[model samples]
Target: MSIQKIISTKSNLVTELLQNIAIEEDWAKIEQFTIALIDNFKDPRILPGLVEKINTLPFDEANAFLVYACGEYSLEDCKVFFDLWIELVAMGDFHTASNAGFILANLPEPFDFNERQLDQAENKLMLALSKPVTEEKALVIKEVLELLK
Candidate 1:
């Protein structure tokens, strides 16, 4: 199938678990993928390089799907995972950040910090909302806060 078709399908498949966890079927393999992704985040490796290419994919859903396929990440690898989450947040892309937050929230123990731990995250979103609200960004913030709750 073409890349566009794949992305369309992936977007359909992507859903927020518990309205919190962003998951796809491949979530079963997340731990393994997380290990590798973490390693790649810290030190470049062959697989990570390929994963980077996958992440940069123009199709937004495609990139997010790749993250799901990797499975549950080990929390020990959380620093890198958290970094990715922050980066996604900083991107100021609501859909992307929402997806990233759901994934980060579901990350198994060691990685999953308390809601309080994300004081900064909450603050950031709050500040973003402090400005004139665009309907789209407003909705995104709503979705994000609900997940955080």
Candidate 2:
């Protein structure tokens, strides 16, 4: 299956579908799509196209699953995604924030983050930390902060 098929050609509507899937907590579908992306990730065209689609998404909520799936790439392939995750985390949706945090924390080694990116991520993380979230997500955010330090 092609990446376009696995993800969706209708960039504007994919967010609604993803939001429903996230709200339903459909692990199988999410994993199925992610695995498909992983299978196709080595293809020369996948990441950039996927990143472009993600960049065009309307809101951070739309990015949660895609970001989580993309987290498996090597740092070399991951650089393109890291900035988007910073933006997602800055939006402070707990699902996206924690998933972004998890990805950031698990990078092969720390990246030299951009100053503005670092500032936004730190501010949002600290804000999200002060709010109520699942204990698990809270832990992930805390670990991400430590990783950033």
Candidate 3:
């Protein structure tokens, strides 16, 4: 089957859709589609906002999206995302922070954080890292960190 067809599955459809759009170099569509998806995440009518948020997240916004998807996490969950951000910080790039806010704006409540909230950002990254890092994602995060460092 075509790549697009394969990505049509519900499980990873959103991620795959974004990936295809990214590969096609279609930022405009990505941004627009993402905006709507993000909005849905803010106040989901169907599934939990996190579910859709995680689905639509592309590689570009994985960290932010992952944190957002995890929702109002316990201390343990916060650490996963925090450690990941630190690795990003050590690389001297703050784009992760930007993405974090982008993802945060769509959260339901309580867990929502502002852009300048480094403490919260750190927590999110730690939360992400604490979880089992998939092989594909691990490679990408490592590469980005290396490039930034």
Candidate 4:
């Protein structure tokens, strides 16, 4: 199939998966879909639409999908993930922030962070660490902190 066709097909798949998540709240399906999508990680033609569709879901669900996307797909230009991550952090969604931080901290070669984004991430991480958080979230936060350091 043509690249455009492949992207279109995958984009449709993501949209369907998002709908299913909304109707069923089945996170397992999200994971499965993410794993499949990651196979095409290098071809990010669908990312814009996928991210937009993900944003329409509830915060928790949207965050979950985005976290998986970040972890699984290490794109060269990851402004999409970076933007969403910053937005999530600004919204005080620490769990998702941790995932985003982890992604940024481990971004692949040719994808280094700029000083301002790094500073913003550090500031957000510090703020999140000071807040009351669940044990699971604390662990994630610590992991991201260690990676950033």
User: lDDT score, residue 143, model 4?
Assistant: 70
Among these predicted structures, which one has the highest lDDT?
2
Residue-level lDDT of model 1, residues 113-144, one tens digit each, is 56665777777667767777557657666566
Which residue ranges in model 3 land beyond 4 Å of their true spot?
1-24, 41-79, 95-149
Compose the digit string of candidate 4's lDDT tens values, residues 64-96: 556657566654445546756654544435566
lDDT of each: 0.49, 0.62, 0.41, 0.61
Per-candidate RMSD vs. true structure? Answer: 13.5, 7.4, 13.4, 4.8
Candidate 3 clash total?
A: 21
**Cα lDDT for residue 83, model 1?**
45
Deviating ranges (above 4 Å) for candidate 4: 1-42, 77-80, 86-102
lDDT of 2 by residue, 20-138 (tens): 43444355675565455555435434455455656656555656766666666444566657767665665546677777777676666547678887777778778877877677667
Listed per model in order, the count of residue pairs whose N, CA or C atoms clash below 3 Å is 5, 0, 21, 0
Model 3 lDDT on a 0 to 1 scale: 0.41
Candidate 3, residues 6-125: lDDT per residue as tens digits? 545543545544444345335465445555444433222212333334334443444353343343332333333443434443222234444433333333445433455555444545
Runs off by more than 4 Å, candidate 1: 1-79, 111-117, 132-137, 146-149
Position 148, candidate 4: lDDT = 55
Query: Residue 123 CA error for candidate 2 (Å)?
Result: 1.3
